[model samples]
Target: MQKTNAQLRAQARGALAGQWGTNVLIIFLSVLLGGIISGIFGGMTNFETGSTQASILEFLVDNLLLFAFTYATYFVALYVVRGGRAEAGQIFVIFNKKYYVPMMIINFLNSIAGYIVGIIVFLPLAAVIGGGVYLSLVISNGQNFGAIADNAFSGVAIALLILLLMLVFLVAVSIVTGVFQFAAWTKMDFPNVKVGNSLRYGWSLLKGRVGRYIMLQLSFIGWYLLGILAFGVGVLWAIAYANVSVAAFYDEARKEIGDPV
Candidate 1:
């Protein structure tokens, strides 16, 4: 039988216990290392004095480094969940061609998907909002102030409704995208697998369990809230917990269904 959300989280907490230092250090270094690279690039390029090509090069390098650290974070998460001694240096360890190539491909694919979805979802929204504003202005033609003021109540109500719908769509997109949670782990576990195949394998594991996977993610909201309450320092611990928790979820899911051959 597959593990319950509670069991998966318990496993994560167990894995993290007495090892919070290592786990948090890995997370911290992941961010710190990325920021350091960006800072170095910025210092060299000096955005204000840099040519267009220099600025573009900096942007590309920065994003590449960010993607590298992201993959390393998952690598550490998988290591911790599987009873390995995760070290902060592993962040740099996973930055090789073997992992970097696939990480960039995955990041590119996800970015393209996001752009397509944003365009599809927002185009109609933009049209509607633009048309509505134009129509309002036309209706309030002769007496702009009085007519708009008279309709302000209805306009505000409509704006609020549109904002609410946008929020709902954003949440739905996030949940749907949860299916890709294990993509990096998939690549790590099967370095021989093609990047596209790795993503497909990950989706196969979560084919019908996205709801449960998202629930596990939602379960961390309270802890995240507490982290925010603690002057934002505790979020580091919360992030470490969340990463390992999802790693545990991936491990169990893989065992339940086995991996791609």
Candidate 2:
């Protein structure tokens, strides 16, 4: 019952198309509710004549909480939601009873560990390259040698640009990692498997089917891109995106694994 990659894909795609409702619903909810939360606090804008802190307080009050809450809740919803046969309330129940704590711990430790490691890897590289670029730019601009080195604004800009680039690179990496994690969860469900086990399982799964998996994941990239482009209108139908994406991936894997897989 071994499945070639193409066979897995076809099976996954077929399963995905069949179960479009589940992921789509979740995506719509995730996007729309996220927006509603944003809008509620948005009008608390800083109209202070000259005080950035005026808005700063407003941003901190709502955003910092939302920053943590929205994401955690959404993931809980996604994880517990199961997206197949579970009701929303059941999903919430799963979140409250079991998943909330462990996932939080696993997610938090991983996040902190990853952040520290990433910074350790990235910062020195940025410092050297960014400083070099700024210095080289200043020298090329025919400035005096002292002035070139002392161009604080240009140095700051260069550093910011490098930081922004790092953020983008990391964000992309984080997303693929997330998909890998989610795929693992889907495959294993809430069985007796530990997080490490799930992660290792996911890595093995990805190794053999990266091409098909990437294709399956990209099926929902449209929802994200469209959600951005349409100023959020696209979020309305995004549930299908999630439903299909997850289904396609899981279904494809099932096909490859055959029967129970």
Candidate 3:
């Protein structure tokens, strides 16, 4: 029998919630790998000279590689170490050995998918934000405040509306992207799933199971809630649990029907 949505979600959440030690281990390491990659990106810090520069060139250099390294590195790391079979040191070794070529290829494809969808859906918002900041600058500096301020309320209102829409759009996209991409990781590493098949298969799986996907994604919220409760030390624990849960999603799901192949 085909699984119902609730069934699927309950299954996914069960892994995330019920498998305490295993879930905690995956999450902790994934977060650690994420931080390692993020720190590498952060090392390219940028300094902006006030007023004279149109924008900081440093920002481009600093974050140009961030998109790839951030999402794809931990993705591959987790994929390679999917089941709880691997120990902590083993996962670290997996991260070291597997990251370069496969991650580049995987992340490049992901970036292409994201850019195509993101630009179409978000170009208007980016244009508006760029225009708003320019307007703000012009109104405050280049032009008289009184003249623009007469219509400033209207401009501010429009900007706020645009910003809010963009924020919601981003969140929705992030959740969906997270689902498909994480699924892609599983499909790529699993017996039957070639990298090419991963995206198409993942999209199909995620579409019919959006609610379950959302529920699993929201489990991260509990991690955050705990982080808040513990003055941030809990975040470390939360990360490990979340990573394990992510790994368990595929492992546990496979148990239901063996390998997809």
Which candidate tops lDDT?
A: 1
TM-score rank, highest first?
A: 1, 3, 2
Off by over 4 Å in 3: 1-86, 93-100, 112-121, 126-146, 149-163, 191-193, 246-261
lDDT of 1 by residue, 16-116 (tens): 87889988888888788778887887778546657797767765885576777777878888898888878878877656878887878777676666667
* Weakest ten-residue segment in model 1 by summed lDDT: 172-181
Model 1 residue 42 CA deviation (Å) reads 2.1
lDDT of 2 by residue, 115-136 (tens): 6757765777668666775866
> Runs in model 2 with CA error above 4 Å?
1-25, 31-86, 90-93, 113-125, 133-180, 183-190, 254-261
TM-score of every candidate: 0.85, 0.54, 0.58
Estimate candidate 2's RMSD in Å.
Answer: 7.1
CA lDDT, every model vs. true structure: 0.78, 0.51, 0.53
List the RMSD of every prediction in angstroms: 3.3, 7.1, 6.5
Better lDDT candidate (1, 3): 1
In terms of lDDT, model 1 sits at 0.78
lDDT of 3 by residue, 54-94 (tens): 13443332234333334443453354334233334433332
